[model samples]
Target: MVHEKSCLIDVPTAEHPRPAAAATLLELMHAQGEVERLSEREQLLSSLLISVNAVLWAIDWETRRVLYVSPAYERVFGRSASLLLADYREWRNSIHPEDLDYAERSLARVLEQGTVEDREYRIITADGQIRWLSDKCYINQQVEPGKPVIVVGIAEDITEKKQLELELHRLATTDVLTQTSNRRHFFECANQAFDTACAQGAPLAFLLLDIDDFKEVNDSYGHLEGDQVLRRIAESGRGILRRGDLFGRIGGEEFAVVLPGCVPEMALLVAERLGKEIQNLSFNYEGQAFGVTISQGLANLTEQDTTLDNLFARADTAMYEAKRLGKNRVLAG
Candidate 1:
């Protein structure tokens, strides 16, 4: 049998190249360009991850292994990324004891819910500083089935935000001068206490106190001394009052206390104790020394009392009577 001869084409020289060869060279150049572009993009992403303030982390859910952690982990958590990668428990150890259970449970919820964005907790840094974090985590959708589930999260430092919130609350609810509850906050809390007492038939007492001859003190010793007296009285009241009692600066040179679970007799004792404490306080303006006193009106919850205003009115009347009878004493309404 005769075999057909296979056709052979001449190989192209460097000077005289074939069309296919040129096309292959062009495709190689294009691929090289694409690779360089990819490398540049990867480098840019790495730089961004390093520079960001938040910590980015990925972990194997089943194995409890840290797969990857960004450089920011060291800065934010004050721990090395290498340690975290070696064992995911490093992250747990950093979390505050009070928040550990919550942080873990919230992270686990990502398995069912696919995401948990409102995860906030406190962490103790390696330097022994406590910091707040707003951690948002999610399940990795790209994780292959039968392989360990992957979880990713970003934790942002929220310590400053929490501190600002606390300061704002203090400004809103606290008296700037005495550091006691402000008038609005005092009345709000007092009204709630009054309603609770009325509902449970619990004994409640209200005490209204005014610094005796406060304007005269301000005029005589100057307003600065008057302010000192107010602050001292507030400090004394806070020290003498029961733990559960509510105290506030209600008006100019006036303070009020809400005594829950205190009967008239016990309330009188509290008032007397507070009065004596104030009576003991002495002040000196330049070379001259002076003492201060308070007029207190104590009112107890009564069957006829329907609102805190009722108690306030009766206490106000009694306080005026105390002023009339002579100050530095407690009187019941």
Candidate 2:
């Protein structure tokens, strides 16, 4: 049989690419013994590779033809070795439509620089949902005049990792009970509103509301029902507000409403409507119907109310007035 001259194997009585060694049987016996351990090492390496969970693949450097695929491909790509033999386009096509452009750009950079590339992309699985994959790729060209420098890539599903990251981000940005903006996110939204107000020379007002008898509810009905009331109030407040307005739970049962590009008159009107909505809401507590209400204070970020603290103080005073004058009415200051 005619073998490629560059074949990586030794032979007898032929032009073997492995260093040509001709000696007596006793001398060759020592050489044969030396290679015995190498066979065991090769088996160990092959066993380790086949058992790995990461999907391993090799593609031709020039034509991008599929050269080798590991058994793990069945778990990730759900395709047989035979299907990916001809070209890499099949795998490329399997990539999520939204991620194709980014994958192409990453691939182009890898080819131009011959540098190792690590990337992630989503792929539609046999199931309908998108599954994310993270990959590490490197060029392997150890042998000279090798059949186009083969690209070796390893991929593993990272969908869980992505989900964890998204959930972490949401936890940071969202209020746990109310699902509205938390204190940290409240500041972020207010900063944007401040920018808008400054750019347009329009007024920005903040309405801070606190449940007058909130602690009583918690002490009487337990924290679980109190939490339910908070969530219901937040949902009802959202219904009354516009899309651009920002509402956040800043403290235990204290919430802040940020209105950008709004005057005193407009803000008072909005606050009054929201106050009644909260009062009318019949907060449910463990299959039991109950009546609950809140007192709110309004403060404008005018020249007089300089800092957030100063503005909040005014709103706090106004809110106490709301409680003093009879709890359910809006105290627009």
Candidate 3:
């Protein structure tokens, strides 16, 4: 049987031909031992890479061709190494469309800089599932200046980690009962919107809503009924608001909405609709028929407004005026 010559096992060639006649049994045995040792070492390295969870790959930088990939490529990317190696475009096409440009820029930077630290991106697997991957790359040395050099890359699956982080952030920022942004998150988002509106000189509006006689509901029924009332209000208000609107539960019975690109008149219309929606909701607990109402205040961004709090305070004052005038109504500030 003819054995393939490997870099690990040194085989004699024409220039260094073996002295077959004078070679002794012990010398042959030693050479055989050395070959076996090197072969085992090569096999172990191959197996180590194949069995690992992360993808290991090397690519020709100049040609943008994949040179080597471990078996984990198939496991992580849901594609056989043969397909990726055959056409590098297949790998590029696997990246998510939203992330493709960013991924290309990252690779270009690494190639230009000769090294890159960790970077995260998303890719679409063969089965059409989106997965997050964090990878790093470095150029291999020992190549001629003008010749094609190799790039070594390693990537690991970070989809689960990213999902967990998203979940944690949601829990931290979302109201548990209403499933809307909590007070802190609401201000965070409102502040950002305020900054954008100021920079672009765009019209923006704020609405502060409060459930009328909420304490009466809790006192007459129970906290559970009050919680149900709040949930129903949130759901109903969300249904009436536009997709671009930002609505959140700012207090136990108070909610806020930030409407981008909305003027004073548009904000008043939205406040009226939201108030009507909440007033029309019908909820029952323990066979008791009860009704609730809401009061809303509307305010628009003004040149005099310096901070989100200024707008919020104006809306809050108008909401209180609404509550004082009538239980179910909207007042514009």
**lDDT, candidate 2, 1-333, per-residue tens:** 886666454454455443334456557898788788888898888898778888898888678789888877767777655777865777887789999998778866666666555788898765556888888787766535745677888888888999999899999999989999999899887877876776667798889888878888888888998888899889988998889899999999899998887788999999888878877878666686776888889988776544566666788899889999988767766
Worst 10 residues of 2 by lDDT: 12-21
- Write down the worst ten-residue block by lDDT for model 3: 17-26
Candidate 3 residue 92 Cα shift, in angstroms, is 1.6
RMSD of 2: 10.3
lDDT of 1 at 42: 98
Higher-scoring candidate on TM-score, 1 or 3: 3
TM-score of 1: 0.79
Write the residue-wise lDDT of candidate 3 on 1-333 in tens digits.
998976764466889866675467668899999999999999999889878999888999888899988888898899878989999887889899999998888987876788886678999999999999988888888667788888998988999999999999999999999999999998999999999999999999999989899999999888988998988888997888888789999988999999999988878888887777776788787887878888888889999999988999898999999989976998888
lDDT of each: 0.94, 0.81, 0.88
**TM-score of each candidate?**
0.79, 0.61, 0.89
Ranking by lDDT: 1, 3, 2
lDDT of 3 at 163: 99
Which candidate wins on TM-score?
3
Tens digits of per-residue lDDT, candidate 1, 1-333, equal 999999988567898777887789989999999999999999999999988999998988889999999998999889988989998889999999999999989888898899999999999999999999999999877667687788989999999999999899999999999999999999999999999999999999999999999999999999999999999999999999989899999999999999999998989999999999999998999989998999999899999999999999999999999999988888889
